[model samples]
Target: MNEKEILERAYLEAQKIVSENSFREFDTSLCENVDFLIDKIGSNKSIVSALATSLLKKITNPEQDIRLHRTDFENGYSARSLDTKVVTPFFKRHFPKYANKESAFLTLSTRERIKWNKNEGKNLKIRSKALKRSFLNVFEQIEDGNANPRVYLNYLFAKLQALSSKDELIFQLAKKQSGRSGVLNINLIIEMLQRHFAEKLSSRLPVVAIYSIYEILVPNLKRYDNKRLLPLQVHTSSDKHGFGDIEIYGDDGKPFEIIDIKHNISIDADLIFDIIKKTTTTSIDRYYILTTFPDGFETKEIEKAVNEFIIQTKTQKKIDIIANGIIPTLKYYLRFIDDYNLFIKKYTNNLVKDAKNSTEIKTFHIDKWIKILKEYKINNV
Candidate 1:
């Protein structure tokens, strides 16, 4: 079988084991090692990817004494391309949470492919010794034929599947608790949202909230209804085609407007210059730079640059550049939204689907809203 087919077969086998609970019969030191790695590793995906990639390579050619890592030389094949081209894409499709992080080999590709013995990679050095030892133990067992490779694969895949399930549960519970407090006061809603954004648990939270607000306001506003708001792009992705955090496509399938959100970062002349440079090629109707910064464009330099750019772009490109704080922007937008309750519902729903946001960020929104709304309800009574 081809390499991809072999990997697929193993994955399918692992899935079957996960479903039928048959892997419990084969549980051994290898399975425990995998559990320990997952527990200790926490969010470090590179090490997990490295472990999976090494196991796959070894499983493909059982005869070769596959080292933990190696490059294409007279001795053996390089795992770099396989990790980047094959394994990375596979993980992206099946496990999106880990997709943002790159494989260990991809990070180490710049250095000479010196065979790293004992499953050691440059990135693994910062991790705990138990994690390092667990990886080495698993690799040695698989290489020496002390443990069944297929069993190890089953445990790894099952462990990851279990983790995804646990995270999904948290997201769902958060969504369930994201109800409104009966009264629809724009001022109260805005205050609750401000509190949530101020926690600063994750930058992705503010972006998600802004995007959710746009999802409601864009369609209702007559001027923006003619345009379509683009979905949120992956946070770590670089190829944004000169668009900002939130993009609106015009009827002509071009960028109509762009909104970039900053979390507590100072907005200065240099920031405005960077924005102008990025949008030089696109003829956008409006560009907004909204921030949660305590001070809103405090310097004269920032104010002057914004005003001058607005004049030049309005005349030259017809793009109106506006900068403001997020709370004020939300207050203005919420004025137009018919039902403030819908904003809470949409925000909660978006939080569940946002893969880039961590579980902590999702829970923070729900917990903060719950506390705020309860207090509001009590005081009103």
Candidate 2:
């Protein structure tokens, strides 16, 4: 299967598992062998992100499990010592009839025996709670980044990616990270989605959510007159470049509008400039920058950039940006597209090697990623 298919499959399986387990009525272990894959898959960027987030808490962290078991072993020795030093002597004194009786089963009022059993059980329950609280302290310490620094939690991410499971996507993510394998040819896909495609399930699934939105946005768009295509790939160099993930041209041979489906709740001036630069030739009537954030997405940056550009140009292009609040269908499956550290640059489908840090600079065209997204989905076309 292809990388896209594998990714979709992994996401669907994780979603299904999460949906079933969400009721607490059907909780069960995921058949996936990837140690952290299910948890990672469930976290953020779907309708059931909470389910995925809970998966982490439900399953024992591998490091914690090891430490807890080790503690149990250590406590076993201490407990055995207590049995010999404290418990044995105490029992001897309490059971006066046991001065010669080894078993302490000989003679006691039935009521007294019942009281002893109840007290012992209560004491054991209290001790059990104490041990749990002690172990829980260790768990909290680990979470707070106060534990041994070397025992990082992300090791679980690596281990989970390198799974021995029947799932194909787990293996694909492993390969992509390895650079030794992975099926999606970025040459065929796009630079941004390529990087997004390789991200953990939580990180990458938003792209799918956005894609589904794009599919229904513009009623009918076909590259050829006779053929109808649900999706069609326009070149990055085309004047029909979309402001976001998709751009559709009119049958009359002029750019109609550009839609930039953003996972980012808010866009800055620079991003607005980037989209403006792409649309300069198209002379598009309207630009729709749709973001999935309902409340936090700030549009002042784009507004400021547009005002500055308009004042400087001294021309009437009749251009404006509209920030549609959220995609209603996917509002529940919202994602916080971290615009700060979201992208990685590539030159000719390989890493851009420079003396300084090219990774630090956000220099790629969003239009290219949109094209790659289009190309991948143009299966029937």
Looking at model 2, the pairs that clash are: 42-52, 189-372, 244-260, 265-297
lDDT (10s digit) by residue, model 1, range 1-381: 766676677678767776786756765787777888777433456667677777777777676554635545445665666677677777776666654345445443223454444544334453476676676677778766557676676578777767666667766665565553376687777777777666755666778888988999788788886899888775543223447889999888999888898877867766777777887877778888888887567777877776776677668766688888888888887787787778877877787777423222444455555566566662232
Stretches > 4 Å off in candidate 1 = 1-33, 36-43, 63-80, 83-89, 100-115, 118-141, 144-147, 179-181, 237-242, 298-318, 356-381
Clashing residue pairs in all predictions, respectively, total: 1, 4
Residues 1-381 of candidate 2 have per-residue lDDT tens digits of: 432233234444444444454323221221222232323322111101111221232232323322212123432112223223332243234211111112111112101212112223233222234332332333344444344312222222222233212223332332233232223432323333334433332222333334443333333334233322123222122112334544545666566655565554465555556766877776775666655454424556655665576444335556765545444333422222221111211221221111011111111222233334345442222
- Candidate 2 Cα misplacement greater than 4 A, ranges: 1-207, 217-243, 252-255, 293-296, 299-315, 327-381
- lDDT, each prediction: 0.68, 0.33
Q: Give the clashing residue pairs of candidate 1, or none.
A: 72-78
Q: Which candidate leads the pack in TM-score?
A: 1
Q: Give the TM-score of candidate 1.
A: 0.78
lDDT of 1: 0.68
